[model samples]
Target: MTRQKATLIGFSAILLWALLALMTIGSAPVPPFLLNALCFGIGGVIGLVWIGFGAGFGVLRQISWKVYAFGTIGLFGYHALYFTAFRIAPFAETGLIAYLWPLFIVLFSGLLPGERLRALHVIGALVAFVGAGLIVMGRGDAAGAVPVLGLSLAFLCALSWAGYSVLSRRLGDVPTESVVVYCLLTAALSVPAHLLWEVTVWPQGGWGWLSVVGLGLGPVGLAFFTWDIGMKKGDIQLLGVASYAAPLLSTLALIAAGLAEAKPILLLAALMITGGAALAARASLKP
Candidate 1:
């Protein structure tokens, strides 16, 4: 299909997996680091399956080292910081701040070569930000600075994520698989470090390890693979607009998992974000 279609599909998959992640499969009875490593490692393996079946090894070799290095490291940094925030702060607070990556895209898009982000982008960003605010506030979790450590790390996660969004475009010709490889490789690098310092590391128990596996294979791995591949097939502008669908879907997933209480206010916010993102997507498509 077309690149825009692929992007839309990819982003939709991201939402699906994000929902899975927020759902909590068995129970989180492990440390964040161990669980993160397990997830990344498993996710990496699943990504390899994509390479093996569809993309191929030659594609992997053809990808730029720069893309591989930056993408891998960038992803690694994002997860590390993000999970750290979870350890230190409340989930709602960390998640809300972390969602700021969409806005980060707007700020960084200008510096990107050929992506002069039109006025519509600015408006869309504001709309999405508003939606994020509703999700954060609607859940009864205000943006407080009480969890100093977790909040600070959460802030770092947002910054890192923003940098990744801006920088990934530089890998224009690199295979999306290569970026996936970078992530897997980064995960591989962490295993050794984890084996050393930590005690009851993330994967402390079977269920905890399963949680890691789910995160890696579904959200982090499979979700990204499809999303990037889809984006590669679609218009970047349209893809950008569709990306907002992830958070909205994620909220729905949260409600199903009992993490989110169904309230008229939050539902309204989700609708607004959805509408705003749809409009923004259309704006990018029109002359």
Candidate 2:
């Protein structure tokens, strides 16, 4: 695909992720690892059906085991760290730290072979981060003693995802189909983790089940596939800057769902994020 088309496709992942908070709330009472297992299991099945219809199972065999390993570590490790961090730390602070991945992606992409680190990219990323920070901090509960370990893990969570995304550019040759193995392996890993750490609890109702399906089908499933395409072939830096929009959009989704109150700060965040993305887009388009 053309770079523009690939970038647009990657941006779709952000759109789907916007629904993550809303869907997760709807799927409530399911513990994190159990929820991880269910969603990734559904995501894996979706990948299986996709491959079965188009590329056939044979395509999977052509992929290297290392690629599968990398994908699994990226998907599973990031979530594992995130869940653990939240378990230990206050949600808002931990989430703010974890959400640093986009900025990290922007910074790390500069290290990739063909990518350049432009001033505007950094500036735009910072601006967008401020917007995302406002949203996260605004939603935060009253402050308490800092949980150092949790904050550290949350930082690692950012690094894990940023590293995964940037490195995907290096493994550009790997087929997106390989994410299926990643999802399945992640699901397998989550099962044992759940068994050890969490009690079993399924979705409580049809709405809950539908929400789980929604997550598997979109945010946790196809988002990865499209993201691979974006990282491999699209404007990675632009996508990095644009990713900050996820928090803003996610908040809007929550408000629309009546889970959160609409706030005046969202307006400023919208402007900052929009301006930041515009700056990044300008930089990307320059000759």
Candidate 3:
């Protein structure tokens, strides 16, 4: 795919992820690990079905086990940590924290060959981080206190995702079909994780099941496939800038679902983030 097309595909994942915060509502009592296990497990099955057992299966063998191991850790670790944070803190707050990944990606890109960190990139990161601070401080959850552990885990989620995306660039040559392998690995680890730390509670009710299905098909399943292709072939800088939209869109989704209230502070935060993203994309906007 051309860089523009690939970047557009990557941006689509951002929009899909926006729905996740809303979907995660009422999924409670169910452990994060269990939820992720089912979501990614079903997603893996769908992937296998899409690729079939022919050339797709053949592609798996060519992938290095190292890629499988690290990729699964990055993807699954982010999900598990993100879900855990939601259980501990408000989804809106945690969502903002988790979005640090894009900034992380922009910074990490500097480490890659041929990618330089410009002055504007540093300013953008600072601006976006300031926006994140506003959102976190603006939360009014029961005395306005954000759990330290929850916030930490959310930041870890961002770091994990950054690692995953950067690693994807390194292994960009890997077949996209190999994502099934990554998903399977995630499912396998989740089994033990669920048994060890969480009470197994399947999603209940129609909305619950719908959320699960949506998550599997959207974020967990197809989004990953598209993202792999995009990260591999798209303009990485542009993708990083575009990812700033996810948290804003997710917060909006939450409000639309009545899971959160729309606030002026939220709009201000969005403006800051958008400005930072724009600055970061300034040079690459046409690329």
Candidate 4:
């Protein structure tokens, strides 16, 4: 794919993620655990199927099993840690905290040999941090504020996600398609655990099952393929920068859901954060 096409895909991936978050506000009765697993597991399998169809599983033969293994573990950690946060915190708080991965990546991507974050990277990261905090705090919904436990776990989710992204890049010659498919394999582990927890501690209805299936097809399956295709074809930083759009899209979702009133102050904070992120993204054009 061309660079321009990759950029469009990158933006599309973030918007898709935003869409999933939006859907969550209206998501049906599936236990969150069961819902998460079905969605993500189905997503990865579809991606791998697509890969197999295109290359007859021959391309997957090129992937390092070790890398795929680590990716599965990383993905397992990422989603489970993230979903757990929702048990103890509000969506806005958990979502904001989980997105701290960009800063974590900025700090660690240098260790991966081929990727590095320079001074402007540091500045951009710091600015982005402030912006993210502002966006979360701007809501003034103290009830939705991140609690101590939720904050810790949410950042853990962020770290796991960061680790997954950086480590996947370090696979050197592993096909990106294979790595992505493998990450979904992690969800296979997650779903059983989720089902166990649901049967023991929570209950779900048929509507919930339907919602989970919808999520599996739309957000999990389609979204990951879009993201993997984009990442393989362009700069990772560009994709990361584009992800800042999630908060904005999510906030718009909140408004539509009538869960929160839209405020001018919140809108400006969104502007500052996304604007700064865009400016920082521009620095990449130079070299």
Winning model by TM-score: 3
lDDT of 2 by residue, 1-287 (tens): 79999999999998887776677667877887887889899999989999999899999999999899999989998877766675676444454456667667766776777667688877877886686566555554733455678778877987899899999999888888999999999999999999998988889999999998998899888998899889888988779767877656666666777765566765566556656655655565465
Cα lDDT, all candidates: 0.62, 0.78, 0.80, 0.63
Q: Quick one: ranking by TM-score, best first?
A: 3, 2, 4, 1
- Model 1 residue runs over 4 Å out of place are 20-27, 53-56, 117-145, 195-197, 202-209, 262-286
Q: TM-score for every candidate vs. truth? A: 0.76, 0.83, 0.92, 0.79
Residue pairs clashing in model 2 are: none
Question: How many collisions per candidate?
Answer: 13, 0, 0, 2
Error of 2 at 148 (Å): 7.3
**RMSD value for candidate 4:** 3.6
Error of 2 at 152 (Å): 6.1
Error of 1 at 123 (Å): 5.0
Candidate 1, position 257, lDDT:
67
- Cα error of candidate 2 at position 5, Å: 3.2
Model 1: per-residue Cα lDDT at residue 109: 52
lDDT of 4: 0.63
**Against the true structure, candidate 3 has what lDDT?**
0.80
Task: Please write out the lDDT profile of model 1 over residues 1-287, one tens digit for every residue.
Answer: 66646666667655654554363333355555565567777777777777789968788777667667777777777777776666666554455556555455544555566545567666766776676566556545554536667656765776786677656555555567775686677777667656775566344477555666667767666766665665355455555555556546666666776766667866666666565656555555565
How far is 79's C-alpha from truth in model 4 (Å)?
Answer: 1.2
